[model samples]
Target: MPKPASASALFSGPFALATLSESDGPAFPALVRPDEKVLDLRVALGDPALTVRGLLEQWPTVLTRLHELASTERESGESYRPLAQFRVHAPVEPRQVFQSGANYRQHVIDLHVAHRAPGDERPEQERRAEAAEIMDRRAAQDLPYVFLGLPSSITGPYDDVTLPEWAQQPDWELELAAVIGRPACRVPVEEALEYVAGYTIANDLTDRATVFRRDMPQIGTDWLRSKNAPGFTPLGPWIVPSDSVGDLDDLQLNLKLNGEVMQDESTKDMIFGVARMVSYISQGARLLPGDLVLTGSPAGNGMHWGRLLRDGDVMDASITGLGAQRTRCVAEAR
Candidate 1:
């Protein structure tokens, strides 16, 4: 029996095979070479030294071999190209994209602060109405405050993000994206995290007018228009397997707009952890491999800054182990 592959192995390059290209179609059990190039398993398997069958039959073994190769390179002082050399697309074509809202206490307070005037009358009726609004918003921002983005919107590493004309305040969110590894239905909270295959970085682009209004339905609801603007979700770089990143709740997340830090917070601040979220979402809907769950964003969004993204603005977002994604904002084509 061949040894299982390590996380680092799957990402190393120079594997005695040609690199895979996006035009080649679906890649199964592929390798990301150190030079940031993709190596198709079908092509690499042709190499006599690393004998393997199809992706499903040999995924574990392939990972192990790649791990060994990566380790050898590290010990021998062999340097390879950076991850930027390889173009990255979504690791899996997901069926659904779920997101949470107001999952942080500070975020909740911030919203209240942004909505109310200083020294405004806090009458009992108004307080009840606000409390009711908050409760409704909670459901609207539940564990998997879910929404759908057309698959056509998906882009890979270093892709340009176009800000739609109506998106006056396009904001950046540094979020931890969980990729489901297996089919899960009504999964218990204790076993929810087990269903995750890996994690990635997601920029939850928002049109403040839309999300805010949608949250306060009495004010108005334009969620579809607000949340589903074209090129809104810029995901990728690569997916890092769950095992490679230990302690899901302890990771630090950061967002840099232009060259300045905008949002800095830890996953520890999350009111609902990943396990609880997975379990809550899977109650009725089945979580298939490649389905993405974007845990909520922290404070310091552009709306909070009283600014909006202009053309040529650069945004970088990263989680501890998951790699960073750099994107530039461009004006939508007229």
Candidate 2:
């Protein structure tokens, strides 16, 4: 078993939104402030039924109110408690999850060269140059590759992820997830940013050995089997409001495995930016409040490092101002 990692302050600036549970009680939405204090939204908003998704449903108004509450200085009382007393959860319960695949410019090129087909005699430099050109062309003329993910796969930021007994090459893909606040259908690319509620982190785990269907080669990739296991997606420490997270295009995503940096890249390397990805997905399906659209992971995945995940390994994933997640891995009981 992996040793317990000490908890650190996950949120920054004035405040962020999170879901926390006290003992075994039900989880409640909260406003996380500085000094490791948390305010129960049910008590702060006077709505016992309040949830993170419910708050996003009324985002514009709720945001203003939350800002006011975060800015207020108050004495510790029934409404507020020390954050250490509670267990943190995935910030929002997303109704739908749309994940982008191979959307990073250099990540795609690297994968292409790394997984060259048999009997290919081309030089590595030549293959790399070809791959780069392919990515450039795709960026200029192709639609983003997006896929669906089940919400059941979501686990808390600090939860233990069970590596299925059958997994041979489990790998991690730390990504930036855009939380949707407003309902959107065929929204223009320019207007897509207006629908984003905030940003959070998601570690999209995959079993590389099962990613392709060997039995039926023509069927292509098998995302369902390789990426949707329960606890495969460790999401959120919290969601930082969009207004507070400036320069979405240049935000950095850093992932460390067992305290060693593996993936460290900027959002500027994405072939398709967040707004383009959201706008494209909305053209086909209506994006609802609390829905998550994961911007693709960057280079330096385990496959690149020749070090896939093993039992007892810990992954620390973080994005810009969205907070971090520390997920410990354990073998699944047979």
RMSD of each: 7.7, 2.0
Cα lDDT of all candidates, in order?
0.63, 0.88
lDDT of 1 at 142: 56
- Global lDDT for candidate 2? 0.88
In each prediction, how many residue pairs overlap at the backbone (N, C-alpha, C within less than 3 A)? 8, 0
User: Residue 4 in candidate 2 has what lDDT?
Assistant: 28
Across residues 193-275, which tens digit of lDDT does each residue of candidate 2 receive? Answer: 99999988899999999988989989999999999999999998888888888698898999999999999999999999999
| TM-score on alpha carbons, each prediction | 0.74, 0.95
Provide the lDDT at 52 for model 1. Answer: 17
Off by over 4 Å in 2: 1-10, 74-78
Residue 164 shift from truth in candidate 1, angstroms? 0.8
Q: C-alpha displacement of 298 in model 2, angstroms?
A: 0.5
